[model samples]
Target: MTVNYEKLRRRFYLRLDAVFSVEELNKLRFEYLSSKSGLVRGALAALIQQGVEAEQLSMWTGLLKECNLALARRLEFIRERESNEKLTAEAVDVSYPARPFKVGLKHPLVRVIEDTRKILTSLGLEHVDGPEVEDEYHVFDALNTPAHHPSRQMQDSFYLSEVGKLLRTHTSSVQIRAMEEREPPFYIFSLGKVYRNDWDATHTPMFHQVEVLCVDVDINMSHMRYCVGFFLENLFGCAKMRMRPSYFPFTEPSAEIDIRRQDGKWLEVMGCGMVHPNVLQNVGISPDKYRGFAFGAGLERLAVLRYDIHDLRSLYSNDLRWKVS
Candidate 1:
């Protein structure tokens, strides 16, 4: 059987010229150029069986090459045109507004912590840290907290199975650790999470606290008073603050510090007082030679008061609509 190379070439170009879409061109290319079942391949196979002359075989090869080149060129042209059309249809106008995108913000609690750290650190206090999971010694006994204290009760605190290990109820434990590691005439602050068996709008099982300790010669309540007032003034911008006598196992004369709100109501913000002689003695510091003051504040409470947030629980809600500013 004689293969009509001229007829095949004419058929290929006729179909190629009629191809209007990339899909149609691809189909046409496969029909004529496929190695396994294409018209060109079948015709070549037939020539192999029929023993076509070398001259005729060379001619068939040249025709096949021309057809393949033409198909590729057509495909490239169609693809380029399609790309341009898509770009034109989807072009953006320079005068149009951009689509809005959301960005994350720092949480209110974190803001309060940083602000407090900045103010206290400026007062010569070095920042320190301690473990959230602490032993009974540092968390309680070393801090002069008696065994019968309410905070030692399981209902008020979280205790572990290790007999003496438990979640720290306050950053005060860090102060004890610092005092044991350093000598007097030093100032340090600890900021991190503390846990208690507590849950309410203003209280969570886990919350952030910043505890400051300054142990130096002649350090008294007056120095503490000035430091506390300076911190509150810088933090809240000229807010009314008052200190009233209170009680804490770690301090000789404990006082609860309060800040007045816009509504003229006083809200307790933190607790402070002179370091107890027992507490200093437990840390191997001489109470007779040196006295200091320590204070602890809740990060969440400070944020709530500063931002005028009504419910403290909302700080932890993680709702996107909740404005930290």
Candidate 2:
């Protein structure tokens, strides 16, 4: 039985013309036009065995070629319409408002450190830094701390090796470094992390310190008082401060500083004193020709006081729930 290729072609065109999607149009085209087992392919296979009939062969060839071109045109039309619909659906509105995102607050400790640096720099202190791991000479001997000082005990300081090198307990080691490298008349301010072997509500094994040093002729307690007063007054907007006689290995006539809090409490802030003569001489500075004052305060303590923080551990808690006041 010979298949009517003309009827098959007409049926294909009718289905292809009616298809609204590229998928359906492709199926209709494949039914008659695909290379293997299609209506057109079956006609070609039959033609091969029966041999020649030039008129029928030419007619079938022309018809198959026309069908292929028409099906291609239909598939292209369906695909073009689909693409246009998608473009229209996804068009952006230039006038739409942008979404609002929540901004985060700076850590309280970071804010206090930045604020301190700004205030100190404005008060004639050039900021500097030093290595946290230090030798004993700079940290202890140059600062006038004796061999048997309680600070040298393993229970207090962290030792890296059997030798005297250890993690710096204060930023004063940085002060000694600057004095060793630069001749003064100079004011040096340093802010950095320091380590010790202590932990309590008011203390941590690791913490931050900010210290300032002034070395020049005739630097006295009056100059120290003026510098501290200017810094605190500007910092707390009229802070009331008091100094009490104290002691430190590095300083002569040492005093502990306390500032009146908003709740009428006197909070001890830091330790400061005139630079001891032996400390000056150890750094090759002639004590008879030059003198200086040094003061060191903890940044965590300042942050606590500045923001009325209840717990010192909160500074390093790393909780996203925490926010600066």
Candidate 3:
């Protein structure tokens, strides 16, 4: 079928002129030309050329240029307005609110550590602390970890120096320091940041740990079980636990402590065992005269298990929304 181009063109222009103001018509024209919609632009141009006067044609051509410039200016204005709005939103988000500011409370992880300390203190364990940056001897050698041990490697542990000084891989270093300083007939517990070369959903390169050590006369596996079981029950509000044989350089007959969750699955909570004779001897204590039991575990892992935290990194993320509730 043959198309009546001029008739169609006049009808479109008539409709456009009826509906739109001069400014809006100019915008529509610019949009049509810029979008390269050939039919619309050709139709409008043909109608303007054929029916319009010479002065009117010049006016329309000038209008087209003005429209293009106005469209460009409008787009820039819109972009600037959007950018200003985003800046305003960011400022509002970061600024203190107009309302009275409530003092920020302790972070959830800090509260968890404090609560764990309170529980340990009640159980006759004194809270102790040690350095985050530690020498190789206190962190590894004194703890009975051999030179060729996997934990001593740079990939698994964060070594700060070529000479092998590092961020402590566990708070167990506190126990080593405690043994060196205090002759232990008493119970000791420590909580602090430790570093390892690990990061994932369930691991962090830096995280907290709680370490417990009980050194006294008649301290045996049974005493170890009792103390650990009591602490787990009190901390989790559940009494069900099972011990599985494991290995640690500083402990003999090492067993990993697992507790039965509500789902009937066993979750390994920590590692505990009789302190190795060599470890005690390293600090000049005869293991034959004074036997002890020691246990250590990641505080983040316990918090994750207890609170159903899916990502271990979330504990340290400082995301207020994720942390608050």
Candidate 4:
């Protein structure tokens, strides 16, 4: 049987011209070049099996081989064309202006806490932290806070659903935790958030505090006063400060330190005194063997004074307009 090589070549080129996709090209390849039923390959095999003359066989084989090469070259051309179309469709324009991005500043309270931490840490005190969710034993009872103290009440404090558990009212609890974990003669300071049931221009339900503690033999009020004074001078610029007698459950002879502002008005800033013997004893330290001093200041209060922020609530209002140093 004679093969019509001219007709086969024409049919292949006709199919190739109509192929608009890689999928259609693949189907055309399978129809003409596959070994099982391919028109070109099967016809060549049939001519050989029928014992055709050597010259005729050579002509048919050569035609089939040329058809295979033509299909391969067409496949490469189609692939290159599709790739260029995709690149054109997905091209990005570099000439357009970049989108505007808004950057943010740190909150005033955080700045105050970080500044205070650096100052206290420079004064030979190590930084420590504790959990925000705490038990009554650490937050109040271990600090020598009396059972009837106003801070233990739900109206003044936040109590969790679990009995005797509450969100700490101050970072003073961190000091209690530090004392319980280590035998002190240790100097440390802590900074973190505290919760209370109050909110106003000067007060917020949640605020930050930095508390410092020093425990060793003969750690007197003078040491406490000097440390507080140095911190205030460095923070607020050498203002005349006075210590007014105040009371706290954890400190004996507690005084609220006040600094004379530039306007000649005294603003109360922090509370400090020698650690109460009961507080030392509660933490398993003997009062006779060691005495210490502790001080705590609200970050919001100091930030307000430093930045001249009018309202404490503004620090938490998420208002981007209020800028601070």
Candidate with maximal TM-score: 1
Worst 10 residues of 1 by lDDT: 316-325
Query: Can you give the lDDT of residue 303 in candidate 3?
Result: 86
Per-residue CA lDDT of candidate 1, range 1-325, in tens? Answer: 2447777888888999899798998798789878888898778777878997987777777778888899889988888989999999999898998889766677777778888989998998899998989999999999888999999999999999998999999999888888898988898999999998988888988889888899998999999999999899998886589999999999989999998877889999999999999999998999999999988898889999888888888888877665534
User: lDDT per residue, candidate 2, 239-324, as tens digits?
Assistant: 59999999998899899988997778888888899999998898889999999998989999888887778889877878775553
Model 3 lDDT on a 0 to 1 scale: 0.80
Off by over 4 Å in 4: 1-105, 323-325
* TM-score between model 2 and native: 0.70
Clashing pairs in 2: none
RMSD of each: 8.1, 7.3, 9.6, 11.2
After superposition, which runs of candidate 2 have C-alpha atoms over 4 Å from their true positions?
A: 1-94, 323-325
Per-prediction TM-score to the true structure, in the order listed: 0.71, 0.70, 0.67, 0.68
C-alpha lDDT values of all predictions: 0.88, 0.86, 0.80, 0.88
TM-score of 3: 0.67
126: Cα error in model 4, Å: 0.6
Off by over 4 Å in 1: 1-89, 93-102, 323-325
Q: Tell me the tens digit of each residue's lDDT in model 3 across 1-325.
A: 0155445445545645453244665555554555455444554477565886676556445545654565566556656767888788877644655887566666667767877888889898899998998999999999888899999987998887557689899988888888999876979998989999988998898888998998987899999898888888888999999999999999998999999988899998899999999999999888889999999889888888888878889877768864346
lDDT of 4 by residue, 1-325 (tens): 4437778878888888887777888888889889998888888898889988999888878877887787788888888999999999998888988789766678777777777887897899999999999999999998889899988988999999999899999998899889999997899999889999998999999988889999998788889888998898878777599999999989887898999988899989889988999999999999999999988889999999988889888988877665533
